[model samples]
Target chain A: MVVRRPGGRSARVRAAVHQAVTELVAERGYGKFTVADVAARAGVADTSVYRRWGDLEELTADVVITWLTRTSPVPDTGTLDGDLRTYAANVVREADGPAGPAVLRLVIALAAAGETGARAREQFLAERSRQLRTMLDRARARGEEAPEVADVVDQILAPVYVRSLFGMGPLTGELADDLVDRMLGTPGRGPS
Target chain B: MVVRRPGGRSARVRAAVHQAVTELVAERGYGKFTVADVAARAGVADTSVYRRWGDLEELTADVVITWLTRTSPVPDTGTLDGDLRTYAANVVREADGPAGPAVLRLVIALAAAGETGARAREQFLAERSRQLRTMLDRARARGEEAPEVADVVDQILAPVYVRSLFGMGPLTGELADDLVDRMLGTPGRGPS
Candidate 1:
């Protein structure tokens, strides 16, 4: 049995370890670094990392979850259109952020890495779908007809991600809004 | 100076080398293997691959171009809806194909690698955009109001790819038709 600290040294150490993992994944892709590398980069002892996360895969998954939760919290702007627009814009910002490409690559790599990676990918998708469902449920409660979770995924999220992953174009706010409009069947301002 | 042969031993050697590169990249992701590995897999001499393509980067780019051209030819079904439906379905099949995920990974990895990778990624996107433009142009000529190439990219291609990359769900034909319908503002059969 161990005494668990809620938001003290343990929280600081977890934060440091996650940042280290994110940077390493960004620079080296996946499967190229080790837990020891993460420990060293986080400026903590290897034993501490091992004691907490067990291995690199677990540590990497934790980092991805933390990043996703922190950066992409579900929006609640009162209306479905406003909620979707805010959600889409937030995604645009996150994908274009400094660590955006790295995190995207990490997620893609994890999806293809096998069972553990597949599990992480599933968790990420489930979390995203859950957030969208929350927004939709709220809109429905307000008597605003909501689109399926699949529509939000296909229309808004997919394009933003594809553009970012392939460097197709800048992820501007207008693009985000247009996607939301397209999904919601509101007349867009016409293509620029 | 080299003699040009359209479909002779030269073509055969090129095909073999491209196949080897595709398999290697699929199996090991990007930047993990070298020209010699490709040569060995293709049953060709290292000097032969070097003499023709110059380096691994050139060979990889050539493989991507070849794959994209061969797999994703633009369809001319006479109607914009038919054409989009066909195109979207083709993308689904490609993404679900044996080498689909590998090629997708290669393209993403290339985009993030460096200058050479960036150039390759640009070339790939340009080629894709050109194909879409041709289809859209034909639709306009046929008196149909075709959507912008960017619209198709954002609505159809992006979703298919994101679904494939993240394993979000099965990329069904219904999903493809629904996407085309959404883009065209057609009344969908309603969500299934």
Candidate 2:
């Protein structure tokens, strides 16, 4: 079967390349890997990857940076708790495919890999920090009781990321709801 | 200047090997590197490393597992809050040395690198989790209001590890103190 795209081929090429990298990293991780492998996996000419990215590290950086920047928008599900729960669940589900936690592990490993990785890590942190700050601001604008932003960020969100890295239990909406209620100084309805 | 130690030469050799590996990772990031390089840096025979650990990844695991297991003892500062603060400060200071965060980055990278790494990573996490459970149990025995253990662990300790991994900011006694207080439901001394 043959498929055709409506838009420019480059966009589809970029998408295929990155998606292939994600799958490879999730399966075998980043060690002793090659860009040629990614190119072949994408069904693109190895020359396209070689001409553009040059190496595995640079190619990995491009894929991670794209994933970080292109995640879903900050939610506005009416209530602060509702938005938080929805977003947290969405974040978890997005990475909870057949790949399991390999995608998240690969992202963290890439960020800690080297100079190229350090750059991606910092950019991802900065981008996510902005998203959190914006979501908090939006919640406050909606007349939600403003909570301690740093506490919510460092204490609540950090755990989610850390535990995710360890593949510790499932990332649940109940867990997100507990975090939201705790941050807002409200009692949860106990696990239903 | 030659100094002699009372311990056997094997102990001295192991110490030098680990110390050399740490220094190398700190300076070079854990990119493509070799065990022969580590042995050369440590002034040990490459065969000694090859005989004990088959590859750079396994050797890397040894260095990190030793570091994680031998970190500061859990503090017993009378009160749970005081103990938590002291231990947290101790953890932060331990990683704030010449090797800096690079050693940590390397450890995490090695853990995610392959099968040997995955085993080492699990060992490290399990060891730390046991230590935390023990500490929380001691606090409860001492009449502290027992909060949810997983929540307490996730909220108070996870941030410390997350922030350390990211090099996000300085880990301070003040920060640890606040985490302990927050877990205990005590109002922070300032900026709520």
Candidate 3:
């Protein structure tokens, strides 16, 4: 099972650590930020930080999980295209913001580390897959999606990921809508 | 502009370096493979390795590029679904191999490391985008795809990535065929 450590370090301490990690990530990027710096900024002992989270990569994963839970998987809106467009637009919008790019950098490095890093990445992906699976299950229950639509869902979601990881192109609002329309074969309609 | 120091080293030397890097990646993962290790394994001078490639990450990217070029793009069998299924199945087949998982681990890591590793990543993404765009263009020209089918391509491809990076599940052959059918919205098919 995947381990997710606690974030509440006595409210005040947790807030400080979070703020410190965020600022450092923004300033230096994930590659430059160290657990030592994070600890120093958080005013906690390095051991204390490690005690709560096993390592910097895992800790960063925890932070990413928290942020993703709050920000991503977008709203359902009862339409796949609309949901995807919202999801894609949301990524661009958020990524352009302060925390977004930094988070992206950190997670990539962690994931690449292999083993531990890969596990962290899986944790993040699980959240996304779970969200999609939930929506698919709901649609199945409601008879909104055909029995075979699960594969369609996989196809429909590929571009958002390709654009993000592979630097293919922008995930604009229009592109997102078009992707859903094309995949679902319901041109000009939102998910319903 | 992104720096791509191609063919700087002799073919034999480059091949040797890539081989060493591949072994190192498979055994220890990308994060653990340092320049010195690669240099020693390749029987090349450390300075030569550094002079040709700026860092371990850049070296990893170059090696990957070499690998991909050797693999070439999947051949067309006329139909879009056939092409995609071939492509997807190939990915699954390759990923199960030594170089496949090794390269995948590296790619996932690079994707996760957004800003801190910008230049190297930009080059990586550009390569991938170019390949996909070429395939999409061909698919469009062949009329195997509608005007909007490229979007479906992106969506269909995402799960392969999700599985690779997150370890959510295997990119099974069955899933690949199903994805192609659903995305194409062929006759006699439901959303399944």
Q: Indicate which candidate wins on DockQ.
A: 1
Off by over 4 Å in 2: A1-7, A20-66, A69-72, A95-122, A170-174, A186-192, B1-8, B20-62, B69-71, B95-100, B110-114, B146-149, B186-192
- Model 1: lDDT of residue B58: 75
Write one digit per residue (lDDT tens) for candidate 1, span A1-192: 977777778899998999888878777767778888988998999999999877777777778877877897788989988898888998999998877778888888887887867866777777767878989999999999887887777778889999999888788998887777666653321111
TM-score per prediction, in order, is 0.87, 0.71, 0.65
TM-score of chain B of 3: 0.72
Model 1 misplaced regions, further than 4 Å: A1-6, A34-37, A43-58, A186-192, B1-6, B33-37, B40-55, B186-192
Which candidate ranks first by TM-score, i.e. highest?
1
Deviation from native of the Cα of residue B171 in model 1, angstroms: 1.8
User: Between 1 and 3, whose DockQ is larger?
Assistant: 1
Candidate 1 docking class: acceptable
- Please provide, for model 3 over A79-155, each residue's C-alpha lDDT reduced to its tens digit, 9 standing for 90 to 100: 64455556656655565445664566566556546575776776766665677666666656665653233443354
DockQ score of each predicted structure, in the order shown? 0.37, 0.20, 0.22
Candidate 2: Cα lDDT at B174: 72
**Best-fitting candidate, scored by lDDT:** 1
TM-score of chain B of each: 0.86, 0.73, 0.72
True contacts kept of each: 0.51, 0.21, 0.37
lDDT of 2 by residue, A102-187 (tens): 55566557545667566666656666777777777887898875554566556556667666655555677666665655655532
Instruction: Single out the weakest 10-residue window by summed lDDT for candidate 2 chain A.
Output: A183-192
- Pairs in clash, predicted candidate 2: none
Model 3 chain B worst lDDT window (10 residues): B183-192
